[model samples]
Target chain A: MEEIKEQTGHMPRIGEPAPAFEAVTTHGTLKLEDFKGSWLILFSHPADFTPVCTTEFIAFTEIHPKLQKRGVELLGLSVDSVSSHIAWVRNVEEKMGVKIPFPIIADLNKEVSLAYGMIHPGQSKTETVRCVFIIDPNQKIRTILYYPLTTGRNMDEILRIIDALQTTDKHGVATPANWRPGDEVVVPPPNTQEMAEERLKQGYKCVDWYLCKKKL
Target chain B: MACISPDGKPTESGTKMLRALQAGLKSPEEIAKETGLPLFRVRSGLRELTQAGLADQKEDKYKLSEKGTKLIK
Candidate 1:
């Protein structure tokens, strides 16, 4: 485990500021600060023109508008060149009938990839594994998800997590497992006995003192 | 058969216009009337289709290119 940890490098922690960098992408130069005041979905795929990555790109394309409606911007990354990125994007549009409307970073130097701990040498020394970083508007890392190369990601789950995170950020509450939009949210428990007693009469559905759920 | 735009994704109106063109609507007015879309929208959709190499215009008449025909299929 320690060896694996050393190989993976430093993993960014939740609530800590996300590692920042400027990179050359298919859409030209982009800086982390450019995404200030908007939620950013910074993700890494293994490579371009690969089967799994292509499918994931199409899925991401399908959800682009939905993410935009929620004020989320997606930025893809791979250890590929800008020319390769453009050709792959064009090929995807021509063959799959889906436009990848997001910018894909060309991290040939592995600078940005290393900063985000995306290049797990144990997985593959030359390629990045599937990794996702959900950064909030305040630039804090809110969530992280890692997937093996064989398994494709669930776009709906990503969206659900974003909704859950945003809800918790806005309302000071938590969500149960498999929580979807419009569901009742869980409120944090009261700190004192008097507050616990007050919480019971606060019109929430209190299953117990520490477990209270309410519609927001 | 690529649908090209700034995003390279076809818009609803663009798809409608392409369908109307494939169905033998020759002019923008004909496409607009057939699809119940505005003339301006039809014109822009035609422009997008043409720019995407899916359609061709000849003497103010619109026809689907081989690529456009394959796309509708």
Candidate 2:
């Protein structure tokens, strides 16, 4: 355990493999490797029954089907017990009329939170700040988002980023600022002069030598 | 269909715009401001949302159709 702490003290970086873990959640026991073939959105909330977290939970539930259609899975975590998680899920369903379909980790020991670097001491010593890690099918961390305790997360942005990442991976291209699906994508800038010249006449909308956009 | 685009695919901006509309953001500019999406993307997303029958535009503002409200509920 000491060795694990030392290794995971630093936050995981994008493009690095997500740290593996096994934990008991509201659904059942799950391992990080269990989601190997699907993209995963591992998010952490400060606590259950909180107003901001509850709203975020509803938003996540609303968008869960869309995420599943794109081969993505959602997992939630907080430094709470399994009983607390179960009760909160029940309460959310009863009051909000939306079922939280994903498993939420009961990180009572803070093991998984530590592994994912979810807890920031400066933010709050007892609870975790809002943290989101977008892991691809290969278990590589693609994007990270952090929100303060007072704010709620934007589920649309989360879904949008998943689309952007998948689009980039599938097309070998980058997306411009605020890019959406069915929109023109950015072509990788050429490294050499010859490549730059060749790119201009490739039937793309080229604004300059290095910048180009083409319909996917 | 609430979040999916008319082309039969899911789009991030489309979802953002839909959520913004559900939150009472009426115009493309307001949607863009609320969601922090680019103006051009917001316009395209609005177009896609309209084509998908989830939203309707008045003189200059947009509102969720009954189908869209049902989807959110």
DockQ of each candidate, alpha-carbon based: 0.02, 0.01
lDDT of 1 by residue, B1-73 (tens): 1224457656566777788888663987788789876343456467668878889999888999898898878
Scored against the true structure, residue A12 in model 1 reaches a CA lDDT of: 85
The local lDDT score (0 to 100) that residue A25 gets in candidate 1 is: 78
Clashing pairs in 2: none
Per residue, candidate 1 scores C-alpha lDDT tens digits across A16-101 of 99998878777555678767777999999999999999999999989988898787989999999999999999999999888888
Per-residue lDDT of model 2, residues B1-73, tens digit only:
2236457644665666777888663887788679875343455456656777888988878998887777656
Q: Estimate, for each residue in A34-123, the C-alpha lDDT of model 2 and write its tens digit.
A: 677679999999999899999999999999989978989899999999889989999999998988888899988888888788877767
Of candidate 1 chain A, the 10-residue stretch with the lowest lDDT total is: A2-11
Docking class of 2: incorrect
lDDT of each candidate versus the true structure: 0.84, 0.83
Off by over 4 Å in 1: A1-7, B1-73
User: Cα deviation of B66 in candidate 2 (Å)?
Assistant: 55
Task: Tell me the TM-score of each prediction against the true structure.
Answer: 0.73, 0.72
Clashes of 1: 0
Chain A TM-score, each candidate:
0.95, 0.95
